[model samples]
Target: MTQTAQLSPSSVFVVSGGAKGITAECTIRLAQQQPCKFILLGRSELLETEPDYAQNSDESALKKCIMENLLSQGEKPTPMNVQKIYNKITSSREIKKTLAAIEKTGAKAEYISVDVTDTPALQEKLATAVQHLGPITGIIHGAGNLADKLIEKKTEQDFEKVYTAKVQGLENLLNCVNPNQLQHLVLFSSVTGFYGNPGQSDYAIANEILNKSAHIFKQSYPSCHVVAINWGAWDSGMVTAELKKVFQERKIEIIPVAVGAQMLVKEMDNTNHATAQVVIGSPLVPQATELDSELRTYRVRRQMTLEANPFLHDHTIAGSPVLPATCAMTWMINTCEQLYPGYKLFHHQNFKILKGITFNESLAKEHILEIEEISKVSFENVEVKATILSKNPEGKIHYHFSAQLNLQQKIPIARPYESINLEEDNIITTTGKAFYQNGGATLFHGPAFQEVTKVLNISPEKITTECLWQEISDKQQGQFPVQWINPYTIDLSMHALWIWTQHFHQEACLPGRVEKYEQFVATPHNKPFYVSCEVKAKTATSVIADFIIHDRQGQIYSRMLGAHAIIWSMKLLRS
Candidate 1:
């Protein structure tokens, strides 16, 4: 289990727009969880006492009393006047209640009445607070305003008010404190920013800025637990009864106050600093045209460079860095996952390498992954046609790899497979150490790809070997970055086929095609697993085989069925 970075009791938190509503609720909950000092920043000034006319908690009774008092003072009781008076009294009451609640939880609560957008005023107030309470340990940037209008109908002032409150207010807070010293930084974003909503263009833009800023700050200060939660509609705060009805009708999930608060605490307690953006609650419905479009082809472009991926330095072939077939599958699967959220690549079929990406020659610097079509095969399954392509200066596209990917919402059970027996009948000809070191001279791979430790048996029918993967330490993590699949382990499985061809045909080879690939679980490191390479057919130019990685009990971890490798000239290995 991952250890959580719990908050300290001495921690001081500065919350913007925290005196009332959702921010107040979250702040109070945090205080309840860990008794800490909270400096609430907002525009409302806390009233010491309620007026005689507004003493009643009942809204109708209080409004009636206020109207009677206005009449007695020879003042008009118009709807606008009544509402203005009602808002002031009720807002003050809420702020007072929040402060009292925090104090009841054995936490210090101080309300600062200042507009967060006023940079100079905010700085002065925060400076004085820090002098009294010491440096701030965390910040919850929840200051935001909503100006709901279409782009053409929205005014410039509307955009300025909504955008400045979130973007500029966060800037003011960061300027007042040192972000590097902060232990936790939470920015309340919205689903509208992630999935654009109508009549909220300004709001969407402001919230998206918050999300982007969270990433920037987290990267700059790796120790700080920064997260921009793209929250859905909540049951309280700005979500009115009418808004709740609308959301329910649209099938949008409403996050309850208690649930949302608990989730916030959990997020703060999490120690995974790599996660900077988190989306909670149900996703908004996309337009029918987006999902049902017949002509839409999703495209993802990424730069291919050896310098960027340092792992390639250890996957050199013929003394040159070459992209491994496993890494190629990873790129394609990653793109598919990105194009379609909430779905994972369960299986890959017809994965073929039309042309390998060789860095030793004129290779494309940028590659494009295109999902040409998505065919729904069943309610829970979909087949995706994805291809990787590149373009030269002449604008001619070259297809490098293509595959049919099967995506599913749930993981399927692993199918049973046959295992190898290294009994006395099966003669052991060479050890894996000898094969890679000197016995297998045609095989050229760096240390990272050399995972086969011992060869138990080798023949025309099959070859069994012992494999081990060394756990990379933090210092060497940069060279072999973590991925969905271990590049080295899969490379080792492919190496089995190469060894078979080298043993029989005396030819060097590279993985050309894979009939099918299924990954059930991650290959554990620093543990010995057996690889059984069963050759079905072989020729002078190519060798076809099935590879399996399993434990001593024959429980399969992963399988590559019908793996095809193309034979290369002996001169290439000598080079």
Candidate 2:
């Protein structure tokens, strides 16, 4: 193996086997453009060969032919010699001079002779080279070997030989390097590491090990950047002429090495994360074939679900377990709160203990009653109504009622008669009318026409009377012979009582159609009362109507009180 270095006076670009094929040539060109020195690490023998023909034309064709010949002879090739031959075949002298030209451009150049299999010696040589060139900032471990023997034909030594040189060499490099000085460590892996082929078990295992080693190194030194470039099949000496023939016959396309190297450089420049696995040829192909297959299956399942008819999907109602009616009530309460704040009936006296009432029985059998207590002094009355309507969605019942009051005095008082003096009146007689009043009536008794009577002084009789007046006809005052008073006095009392009764009635009404002022009708006298009755067809259902009353202004009087009456008549109607 021959090594070459492209160098600027300050920095060295090191290429192992720089005089070899496209890999070596590309490395020299990259060194030329960058401001760096170069140190090529390779065997001394390859450096002595001419550029035109450093080795025999069949030299690239040697590994497989030798392996086959040895296998046919029933002799297994020694692992160490196989590795030595692999390294030697990859080294070239002309590649080294090309790297030297890059160094001539204001850069330095050097070559270090070292065997990778000797870990300590290799580390010593690398450290010496870094000391001479300057502290090493990056290292690309591109050295590798491949074999095309099937697992059955492959000996354990074959596997160990390839893996140790490639995987172990990279691992040793990571171990020997000072992590604080190195910014990037690039490992060249093969697609075979991720996807296995029929006859490349040894090659696949080596590459897989290399990939894992990169990850291990990265984890061990988190600050030190690591990258594994899983390159596709490249046209190189490693892929010999005979192997190329086999690959072409198998319709496998070889990837250009330049493209792979460029991608590696780009990824190394990226500072997003320290570790990355970059595949060169196909973007979609996963690094692992088994994982790729599983992903594809999952995608297919998801697509089938997406393609199915939406209508066929099941949509069971979701939420807390609750009866339909109770759920409806909860929803209604929430909706009411949202629409009209402070209008919700949850805390009303009638709305308390909501869940216990039966809608049907309550509305049908219960008669609404309103009691009023009237005070003559304040002329105010307190009215209370009791009735049951259909349970509101909010679990409240309604009632309807009216009240009347009469305010009258119903007692009579007797009046005293005039008194007379008789002692001094015997000589003088006086004539006077004697009058007496009793129980609101005037009368004269014990008096004759032109009577000589001793009446000294007489005062007008005074009488007081009261009556407990019941409602009577307006025209019947004369027949009863009682003092008639303003008829409106009684009417006003009744009207006031009616007003008081309505206040309680509305309070007791449930929130529904009738209570909501829909069925209520306004009368000519401006009284509000519900005229329409709602009948529900089912026991579980309810009907709502509005209660309308008339206002004093003669316009139709209605207020949305939310009165709902449940039809309890369902059973009776069914019967």
Give TM per candidate: 0.65, 0.40
Instruction: Give the Å error, residue 97, model 2.
Output: 3.4
Judge candidate 1 against the unseen true structure and give its global Cα lDDT, from 0 to 1: 0.79
After aligning candidate 2 to the native by TM-score, how far in Å is the CA of 523 from where it should be? Answer: 76
Candidate with top TM-score is 1
Error (Å) of candidate 2 at residue 12 is: 5.2
The Cα local distance difference test for each model comes to 0.79, 0.40
8-115: candidate 1 lDDT, tens digit per residue:
878889999999988898889988998899999989877778787677889899899889989999999998999888888898988999999999999998999999
Q: What TM-score, to 2 decimals, does candidate 2 have?
A: 0.40
lDDT of 2 by residue, 1-575 (tens): 11112223454334444435554555554554564666665544444544332234455466655555567779887766655655554454354655566566555666666545678877888788888678765666666655568678887787777777676776666666666666666667778776656667777778887788777866765555667778777776577899778676545678777665565556655534534566665321111111111111000000111112121111111211111121122222332222222122211122222332222223223222222222222212111222222333465555332212222122122122122121232321222222111310111111111111222221122101111123333243211111122221211112111111222221111222222211122122212211111111212333232222222232322222333434232122112
